[model samples]
Target: MASTDSHSCVVYLVDPQDGKKGTVVPDRFRRLAIADGCGVVGLESADEDGGSQEELTGLIVAAIAAVMERQDPAELGGDGRAKVGAVAKQAGFKVTKVQFDEAWPKYVDGLGADDEDKDGE
Candidate 1:
């Protein structure tokens, strides 16, 4: 999601069940998360830029986890989104929600392409 002013983009990795918030990490650590649940991660572009989308996503997720781990548990309570936002802001990215209406077509196209690839195989 790009900020209203177009300065930054936000990606939300919210939990579908209880709206638990997080981001995408590496395969090895994501496997661990399957059992332990995802921890929050936020990354700023200034710290380091990844060469690929996968690398950048992994960095964002790891940073969120690191920031959350340092916070006081009692302060976090049930307000996971707030905590995630705080971390993201501190990292220098402005938070903004992406509109589902605008985003859905890209997802559908991607999924369709994936299906076509499988059919070809």
Candidate 2:
């Protein structure tokens, strides 16, 4: 939960019955919430930048809400997406899905070695 002395925000990753997980990013604009039943909640942030705590809070809130309304965390990277989803939910943002093929290469250190040539072939 991200919070100030008077307000706080919480994000939740919910796994409803059907053996699938869902994410809920709460908008910072929203302070109170009621969970439906199954899910995990994570708090993202709580601080003001340049005296715009309220604005930042609102952006977080909207982003989380957008994510919950438009994304499926399972599609991104399973648990990682779930965690991000929770944070987004708490902050009120939507999870943006990108093509893995395009994004993976940038972060992947090395391609797997050929099985027959394990000696750095």
Ten residues in sequence with the least summed lDDT for candidate 1 = 94-103
lDDT of candidate 1 over 1-121, digit per residue (tens)? 3233454322347845557566555543432342233333553333332223334234344445455556856324384422545434533342223322232344446558879999999
Off by over 4 Å in 2: 1-51, 75-82, 85-121
Query: RMSD (Cα, Å) of candidate 2?
Result: 16.5
Name the best candidate (by TM-score): 1
Global local distance difference test of model 2: 0.38
Candidate 1 lands at a TM-score of 0.28
Candidate 2 lDDT for residue 43: 29
